[model samples]
Target: MSLLVEMRGIEKRFPGVHALRSVRFDLKPGEVHALMGENGAGKSTLMKILSGNYQRDGGEIFFEGKPVAPDSPRAATDLGIGIIHQELSLMNDLTAAQNVFIGREPRKSFGRLDEPALNRQTADIFSSMNLKLDPKAQVDTLTIAKQQMVEIAKALSYKSRVLIMDEPTAALNDAEIAELFVIIRKLRSEGVGIIYISHKMDEIKRIADRVTVMRDGEYVDTVDAESTPLSRIISMMVGREVSEKPLDVPDTRGNEVALEVRNLKRGREIRDVSFTVRRGEILGFAGLMGAGRTEVARAVFGADPRDDGEILVHGKPVSIHSPSDAVRSGIGYLSEDRKRFGLATGMNVRANIALASLDRFTSKAGVLDERGMRETANNYIDQLGIRTPSDTQEVRLLSGGNQQKVVVAKWLLRDCDILFFDEPTRGIDVGAKSEIYKLLEELAAQGRAIIVISSELPEVMRLSHRIAVMCEGRLTGILPGGAETTQEQIMELATQRESAMAPVGEVA
Candidate 1:
């Protein structure tokens, strides 16, 4: 089998950060090569270099054993390289066909956009992939899964032989993932090489033929996907033996209820949901995608308005029309999409940590306490073991795990007794995940009521003292968490519709 793509001695550097070291990688025709690494381990950077989104400071790239230099994305595309970023770059307001051929749309007489020809070409490409998307459909109206199919269509339209997918399944559901795998297998059988980048161990196991691990911008090792244990791949990526201890589920019946919701409702996205979180307890919210776990959290935290519901803090009904009101009532929410909702990425850690409680740090004369902010930021930086040059470092420069910790620090500074972490460790490495697990446990030990919303069943079972399952925005059931719990039990409730719903406090 001949090599489809090869990269050697790849190096990239930013102002003060050495983003990549002497990294090397290769891909064979008709193979799925998985790229595994922690955030900031330089996997994306290397891919960008290969896809010509960024130029390598020093390296050599070859295509079909011929030396090539792709200095721009268009150049790479011309050479049959296509990259689908983690954040989809499609223009949502445009039609699917328009988005697929943004720059190189077919032209009619006098160079006018040939709309019919464009749609016809797009339909042809979609049909070739056995896809069911409408070329004339609005991108905004499509689901994330469908939008991804459009990205793949765009790639195939370029006649790309090598497709690079970064965290492709991050926003997709189980059914959507299965559909994507079918497309991947079809492409593989057709002799297309795929570069698969993801943090999900199970996904790589299911789809990859070979696995390459990178650590802190350097190539660690590449192993056979079928022959290597996940534990070994994880250790190679993190350079350590990461261990997991069984969660100790304590009896919290005697604990004080910190927060409670009765009949939370928000259109069809969220139904009449009700639940309670006791002090010193972790309540895991489990559900499938769009099952309304995050909706329940946002509703309670005042991030989204609920049509009818009562939120009580320590037995007193609280009026939370906005996030400020929720914060005043001692509630903090760490959103799943942290970059968009949780952190001020462009700002420094000190500024973000003090963001939720800036009023508390201001003097009567209206002066800001810079020194106090620094002290507080440094305090949490040390406590949380955040890897940063200083408290003044920009949050965007930090890895995904460290950025998440910064969000955790912000909530901690607000002194919120009730914290909701939605998809808390998504996109983080296994090492960082273990740390986050430890942090959540410690917070619970300190008598904080924590609500964790996660799509991963094992994470919910491992972290929560109790699991609350939702289906179509309704609370289907709640179960005790720990070794006694099975994923099957959660899934049963997760898919249970309103017709099969048992009232809250009524599920045995």
Candidate 2:
């Protein structure tokens, strides 16, 4: 394999932070190089420089044995370099074909729009990739996995020689992931070099040819992915051996029930869902994609309407018609896509934390009590150990973990006792995940009832006192969470369906 791309001595700085420091990276023809790092480890910074999203403060880039400097994304695309960002960047209202050829659509004789030709071209691209998709379908109507495939099809349309994919399977199901792997392998066979960025060790082991580890803005080392132990790669990224300890189960069973759902049903996504969480317990919801874990959480939080169900807070039935109703009933929900549903990224930390509880911060004369809000925000910042320069720092500037803590602080400020965390550690690094886990334990110890919905089986097994497995919009089974619990057992239950729902309290 010949060298296709090389980046040496890359450095980037932003205000008070040195994001990347003399990092080096390289890729060969037909190679799938996995970039592994903690959240702030400069992987994205390096890639942004490669894709011309940001200019490198200092570096030398070589493509095909020659020096190259791409001043913009367009220039990089012209140079056969393409990138699929972690956040999917597709216009929701546009058709798939329109998004695929936004600025470079085929034209008619009079320079009018060539609708049929455009759709045909888009369909051809999809066919080449073996992806079944309608070119005329609206991007918003497609599933996240389908939208991701479209992103890939768009990149391939550029005939890119070097492609960078960041967290490509973040929202994909097992089947969709398999399909993507097939496409990636096909591209690899065609000698298209791929730079794959991800946090999932199993995925890297299965797909990557080589793994490059980065820590704290510096390149650590690169090794054959299949040969290197995952623990070694993890240690390289974090600078320490991460403990693989099982969660210590506390005696929270004797605590009073904080919340209960009876016969919860919503469309076909949530059917006859029933569960209970004690005041000082963490109940884990585990399932595959589209298994209705998120739907259950949303319905319980009143973000979505429930068809036939009853919710009780402290054993008393409560009617929740809206999110406001849930909040007033002492319930809080942290959505999976925090950027879209949880935080106001443009706002400062103090403002976002105080957003849900602004009613208490307003004086009787209708004036904002800025000092009080600041004091409260500072208290939560210290308590939660949120790493921010100051409370006035924009939420968008913080790392993934700190942004999550800010969301937690918002609900805490609102005095929510029955809390739901949906994919709380979705995109955070391992170090940040440990911190979030500790914080959840602390909250549970403080007698707050917590429900955690996670796709990772290990996370659910480690965090909850009891695990609830769902399959096809129904509660399949509940298992005890401890060292005795096995992934296979949970998976089995997750794939089971109930003929008649039983009371959760009576389940073993």
Per TM-score, the best of the predicted structures is: 1
Off by over 4 Å in 1: 502-508
lDDT of 1 by residue, 136-218 (tens): 99999999999999999989889999999999999999999999999999999999999999989999889999999999889
Please, what is the TM-score per model? 0.97, 0.96
Residue 67 in candidate 1, Cα distance off native in Å = 1.4
Clash count (model 2, backbone only): 0
Best by lDDT: 1
lDDT of each: 0.92, 0.92
Query: Could you tell me the TM-score of candidate 1?
Result: 0.97
- Candidate 2 residues 164-277, lDDT tens each? 999999888788889899999999998999999987779998899999999989999999998899999989988998875768888776789999999999999998989999
